[model samples]
Target: MDPISLILGAILVGAAKGSGDVASGAVVDAYNGFREALRRRLAGRKPAQTAVEEYTADPDNWRPALETYLQQADAQKDEELLASASAVLSAADPDGASHGKYAVQIYGAQGVQVGDRNIQTNNYRSGP
Candidate 1:
């Protein structure tokens, strides 16, 4: 959905991968690159750095603070950081579509769209 949510999800995924005992070198490298990029972006901002560290520990609890800082830093617009985060997510979840954890049910919907970067131009015209 939103950029902050995307970044937070990437962070959580990277953290999970790093915590695993059998993580691949590529995954680890990608996670490290993402973290480093974030760290660099939040270099002089103590609160932002703290938010990141705290959010890693308790994501749900620290989400707002972390989100605020991330927005303040314009992290979504940071190409390097976004690329690094994408790398971590790609390395951790190569499927790029589903990780065997989704159950979506849409009912009575028109022009329904799922996932990101989507463009759905719907035109309903009266005809016979």
Candidate 2:
């Protein structure tokens, strides 16, 4: 997945968990912070604000709107927003269901490893 989708997925998962009793303490706090960050980023836009409201009310059905809102807000480029969303996801799903239980999405990546205990060393040098 692209960064945009990755972050959006995290936000959605966090939202789902946060709305339920499963979320408490740190999870709730992180989820709230993520929502607040999104709200601040989308302020002064009635449609965006409406999308957020709708998403909060019905996360399952309002995802497309929130996704659009995120795109309009340029969420992918906002490291702070990304971090906030990631925090919520981490707090809500500590086992990293963020990438799916056993799935990972990697694109244009190098020397990436998963599902194993391994060591890697990189000696990258670029020249003509």
Candidate 3:
């Protein structure tokens, strides 16, 4: 995924999980942008507005439905639409899910600040 999309997705998800009703900061802008993009794609298709609203209101419940549209966008090779859908989906399920399980793992670090740096460690080291 592109860096912009990734960041927007993260912000949107954070806002969705953190904000109560109205999102603030980049989250609001990102959500609006994604929604507008998705709206354009759904213009010809009815029930889209409702679906989008549902996603905005309750993402966790409507994620699967949104994903269906995402797949359609993928099949058509519509990168823009795909990114928009991905943004919404990411915001809906920040933890991310695939095949009925979490796709991303969260690891905690002790006595250190884990910034953007990537860290890998051997969980089962045999000897020192």
Candidate 4:
């Protein structure tokens, strides 16, 4: 490969990785925020009533905001966004796999298998 092509490829990869990181961070932050809010509510601390209104006032909703950041980080490449979103979503799930191929068995009243469902699992990992 030409030097320029190699450099471009490296840049693209770096951007995708960065986008994934940003998306993952945003999701984690949102999760933490929600948890804190819940804790405060449970503790009898009344949350601001306008919080939801303020959130909705933003042009992009929560998920869309994170996605916009990811897209910008990846130079607006559809493929890059798809790849990064997959990575971020996987990071949010238990198996660390980009796609869902896992199932959770549901039990009935008598502990009999009733059905199965797919659930999103959020498992975080530190650096190797």
Among the numbered candidates, top lDDT falls to: 1
Tens digit of per-residue lDDT, candidate 4, span 1-128: 22212222222323343344454664554344433432333243222223322333442334234333333344223343233333333344536343342222243433232112323445567799
lDDT of prediction 2: 0.69
Candidate 2, position 68, lDDT = 82
Top TM-score hit:
1
| Poorest stretch of ten by lDDT in candidate 3 | 97-106
Worst 10 contiguous positions by lDDT, candidate 1: 97-106
Clash number for every model?
Answer: 0, 0, 0, 1
Model 4: how far residue 24 lies from native, Å: 8.6
Alpha-carbon lDDT of model 4? 0.34
RMSD of each: 8.7, 9.3, 12.1, 19.5
Ordering by lDDT: 1, 2, 3, 4
**Model 1, 1-128: lDDT tens per residue?**
34566578678878888657798888899998899999898889999998887888898789889989999999979989887876777778778626621123456777775544445689998899
Better model by TM-score: candidate 2 vs candidate 4: 2
Q: Write the per-residue lDDT of candidate 2 for residues 1-128, one digit (tens) a residue.
A: 34555556556666677767666788788878887877778888888778766765686678678778778788778877777776776777678645563345687887664433435687778898
lDDT of 3 by residue, 14-84 (tens): 44653566554444554666656656666765554565556666766774575565445442355565555
Query: How high a TM-score does candidate 2 get?
Result: 0.63
For model 1, what is the error of residue 126's alpha carbon versus the real structure, in angstroms, after optimal superposition?
30
